[model samples]
Target: MQKRKHWNLGAKLAVAAAPFALLALLSISLTLWVSWQLDGGAAAVNEAGRMRMQAYRMSLLVAAGERTLLPDARSEFERSLALLSHGDPERPLFMPRDEDIRSRFDAVGQHWRQYSKHWLDVRPADNRGLREETARFTGRIDALVAGIEAHMSRWTALLNLMQLATMALAVIGATVLLYIGYLFVLEPVGQLKQALERIQQGDLGTRVERNSSDEFGTLADGFNDMADQIQAMYRNLEAKVSAKTAELQEKRERLEALYEVTSLIATARSLEELARGFVGYVARAVHADGVALRWSDEANRRYVLIASQGLPAYMTDGERCLRADECHCGAPNAPPFARVIPIQALEKEGLQYCSEAGFETLVSVPVRLKDRLMGEVDLFFHAEVDLSPSARSLLEALATHLASGMENLRLNALQHEAAVSQERNFLANELHDSIAQSLAFMKMQVEMMRTSLSAHDETGTRAVLDELDAGLRESTGDVRELLLHFRTRTNSEDIEAALQATLRKFEHQSGVRTTLTLREQGLPLPPDLQIQVLHIVQEALSNVRKHARAGHVWLDVQQQPQWRIEVRDDGRGFETGDGPPDETHVGLHIMQERAARIGARIEVFSTPGKGTSVVLTLPASDPTLLDLPPLQAVS
Candidate 1:
C-alpha cells in the first residue's frame, strides 16, 4: 500500500504555535522600531552639545590671549578653531551632520576671523574692537548653548513619551495574544479534554463540536469517528449477547410455539385465542405499542380485522374490514416480507388505526407463505427507535416464525401434507439465481445446436456440443456442491471436524498434502453462519483441486480483529483482471457469492508462477441474509 499523507502531531503543534510565534515577532519588531525612533533625535542633540563645548574652549583661549598671554593657550585656541571649522577634532576626517550645531559653528568662525584680525595686533586702543567682537560672540555662544540644551530637553520628553507608547503597545499586544491563546487554544482544548473525560467515563455520545477548518476541527472529527467505532463495538457486543440469548431462548420458544400451535390447531379450538396470543407475543417481543391480526379475505375483496392487543379506538372502530385497495399490508400479489415503515404526515388522518394510537412507525408483517397471505400482524410504534441491523434481522425472523406458525395451523386442518412441496418452494428461489440461470443458458445452447444440426452444419453442431458438455459439467458441479452443503450441516462446535473432513477429502481427491489449522480456540461463529463459511472453504479447496495442480495447500482459520480464513496453495497462479470467469478456476463465483451473503470481505491474491491465496474476513456483527443454496433438485 502507498503511504497516505496525514496531518500528524507535529502539524497540530505547528498550528498551535502560530499565535505565539506571531506575538514574539511583534514584540521584537516593535521594540526595535521604538528604540530606533527614540535614538533618531539623540545624534543631532549630542552634536550640538559638542559644538557648544568647542565654542566655550575658543572663548577661554581668546580670554587667555587677551589677559596672561599664554602661548600654549593661543596655540590651543587656534587648534580648537581648526577643529571646529572642520568638525570632530578627535576624528578630523569627519564633518558634523547636525545642521543647527554646524550653523552655530559657522557663525562662530565669522566672529573669530574678525576678532582674530583685531586681536592679532593687541594694542590698548584696538582692544576695544576685540572686546566688542568678544562680547557679541559670547552672546551668540550663550544662545547656542541654550538652543542645544532646549533641544536635549525636547528629545528627552519625546523619548519618554515614545517609551510609554511603546510599553502600552507591548502590553496591548501581549494581552491580545493571551486572550487569543485563551479563546482559541486553551478554552477549546479544555472543552475537548472535558469531553474526553466524559468519554472515558462512558459517555459515548459526548462530542467536541469544532466548527473551524483547523486542527481542532480535524481532532473533533477524529474523536467523533472513534466514538462511532466504539459505539459500534458496544452495539456489536450487545447484539452478540442478544444473539446468544435469543439463540437459546428463541430456539426453545420456537419449538414450544410450534408444538403448542400444533396442539391448538389439532384440537380445532379457539383459533382466535391462538392468533391473539401470537400477536401479543410479537408485540411484546419487538416492543411494539400495539399489534393487530387481520385476516385477508381476497374472495370477498376485503380484509377483516380478527384479533388485537394494545390497540386504540380509532384503528378498528369496534371491528372493521378494509378493501383490497385500502390495504397497506404489502403488494397484494407478492409474498409478504416484514418491513419497518414510517408514518407519513399527509396520510396520518386517513390511517384511522394509526391516528389514534399516535405511532411514528410500524412493522407490517404478513403471516404468509409465498403470496398466500392468510393474515397479517401489524406492529405499531408510538415513537421511533434505533434498530440495529441485528435487531431488524431478529424481528424479521420472528415474523417468519409467525408465518410458519400460521401455516402450521392450516396444515393441521388436513390430515396429511407433502413435505416435498415446502422443500420445492425453497428450491425455486435458490435455483432461480444459480442453476436456473445455467439451465437457461443450456436451453439457448440446445436451441442453437438443434438449428445447426437441422442445417447439416457439422462444425457448428460440434462447437455447440462442446458448449453443452461444459454447461452440463458446470451444472453437475453445482449440484454436487449443493449436495455437500445440505448433507453436512456444520455448527460452531462441529466446524473443526467438518473442516478436517473437508481437508481429508481434498487430499484424497487432489493427492495434495492439505493441512488444516483452526486457531480461533474453536471457531465461535453463530450456528447459522457456520454453514456458509464451511461452504466457502469447501469451494475454495475445490478450486485448488481443479485448477492449482499444487503440491500442497494450507488452510487457516483465526481471529485478528475479525474472523479470518485463508486458503493458500503453492502453485502456478494466473493473471487477474476483470473479464469472463475462466473455466480452469471453478467454484470462484460460488465462493464470492457466499462471502457476500454473509457480509464477509473476500480477497484473492496471486502472482504468475508464484502462488495463490484466498482470504475471507467475517465481521462479528454481520447480519444474516437469505443465501439458501438449491438444496432440492428441480422436479
Candidate 2:
C-alpha cells in the first residue's frame, strides 16, 4: 500500500495547536491547584481563628478556677491553633505552632484571676488581693480576645492576597503564552509565506533569518539553503547563455567582414585603387603598418612594385624593380623594418623568397588569377604587435579578395587592349578604302583629261594638260600622306622624324607652310605610351588641316622632365568654351581619350579670327624606359 502524504493544512494545524494545547493544559492545571490551595488556606485560617478564640476562653476559665474547662479540651484547642499558625497558606494545612500553645497559657491565667474576684466577697482581708487579681484577669481576657481578632484578621488578609495573586499570575501567564505563540509561530510563518511568494516570483536570492535553535530556525536554515542552490543554478545558466551569445556575435562579425571584403574587391577599378583600399582594410582589420603589391616582370627579369601604402615616399618612387635572386623582401640581411614577400611564383619553385625586412612581422598572400600567378601582396606590422587568429583569418580573406579583383582588372585591361587594337585595324582599313580609292579615281580622270588635251588643236591644250597634271599630282600627294600616317603606329619611331614627315606631307597636300621646332633631344618614352603621344599629335594635325584655314603652321615638340607637343595654325579659330566639343568633332574626343589612356593631359586654346593651338603634355617616363620590360610582357 502507498503511504498517504500529509496535507499542508494538517501539518500546519498540528504545529499550531500542539504548543497551545500543552500550554493551555498546563495553565488550567496550575490554576486549579492554586485555587484549591487558596481555598484550603482560607478554611485553615477560619478554623485556626475559632480554635484561638476557644483557647483564650479556656485560659480565662482556668484563671477563674472554672473546672468545666478541661485540660484535654485546652490541649486540643492549642494543637489546632498551632496547626493553623505553623501551616503555610500556599501549602496544605498540616503543621503545629508554639504561639497557639502560649495563647492557651494566657487563657489559664485569665481564668485564675476571674475565680479570685468571685471569692473576694466571702473573705475579708484576703478578698482585697483577690479583687486586684480579678481585675488583672479581666485585662488578660480582653488582651486574649484582641490577640485572637488580630490573628484572624492577618489570616483572612493573607488568604485574600494569595487568591488575588494567583488570579493575576494566571492572567499574566496566559497573555505571555499567547504573545510567545504569536511571535515565534504566527509571525515567523507569515514571514516564511512572504519569502515563498518572492521565491515564486523568481527572486532566487531571497532568504529568511534563522534567529533561534528551534523549529523555525531549522526552517529558516532550509529556506536559505534552497535559495542558495537556486541562485547558483541561475548564475550558471546565465553564464552559459552569455557565452553562447558572445560566440554568435563573433560569428556574425566574421560574416560581415567577409561580405564587406567581397563587395570591395568586386567593385574595385584599378590596381592602385585596389591596393589602397586593401591596405586600409587590412590595416584596420589586423592593425598593421601597411600593404604592398609587387609583380614579377619575366621579360625584364625583375620584380616590379605596383602599389604600396604606409611606406616611405622614396621607397615607393625609387627603384621599384628587383632581380628575382636579388629580392630583399624576405631577406634576413635586409632592413629590419621592411616587409617583403613574393606573392606569386613565376615557375614551379614556391614562394620565391619572403622577408619581413625592417618590419617586425609580415604576412604575404599571392594574388593568383585563374590559377596563373599574377603578383604578391605583403602586409607589414611593428615587431611588438601580434595578430590575433581572427584578424589573421580576416587578412587572409582580404588577400583572397584582392587576388580575385586583380584578376578582374587584368581581364578588363586585356579587353580594353583588344578593343583598341580592333579600332586601329578598322581605322586603317577605312583609310585604305576611302582615301586611296578616291585618289586612284582622280588620277584616272586626270589622265583621261590629259589624253584628250593632247588630241585637241586649240592653243590652250598644253595649259589644260598642265592643269590636269598638277591636279593629279596633288591627289597623289594626298594618298601618299594617308599611307605615311598609317606607318607611324609604334611609339619606337623617332618623334622628330614623325613630326617632320607629317608636316611636309601637310604642306604639299594643303598648300600650307609648316615649321617644326625641337626644344630638347633624347625624349625617351615607353613604346605603348609613346604611341599614345604620337596619336595626340596626329589628331591635332588633322584638326588644323580640316578647320584651320591657316597659310602657315608651327609644330613644336619639346621634351624635358615632361613631354609637351604643341601645334598652332594661323587660321580662323572658334570661340573658347568649357571644353572641346564632344560630338561635332570626334577627332578632339579621340585625342583626349588617347591622352587619358597614357596618363597625359590635353589643352586647346583658340580665339575667333585667331589661330588654334593644341597642346598635349605627359609626365616623363624613366630615363631607363628602354631597359624595362614591355608593358604587355609577362614577368
**Residue 301 lDDT (model 2):** 51
Candidate 2 stretches with Cα past 4 Å from truth are 1-207, 210-268, 297-302, 313-319, 323-358, 429-433, 449-635
lDDT, model 1:
0.65
Q: Per-prediction count of colliding residue pairs?
A: 1, 30
Cα-based lDDT at residue 510, candidate 2: 77
Q: Which residue pairs of candidate 1 clash? A: 315-353
lDDT of 1 by residue, 495-570 (tens): 6788888788667756899888877463356555776787788778767765677898999988645678999999
Which number leads on TM-score? 2
RMSD per candidate (Å) reads 26.3, 22.3
What's the true lDDT of residue 335 in model 1?
40
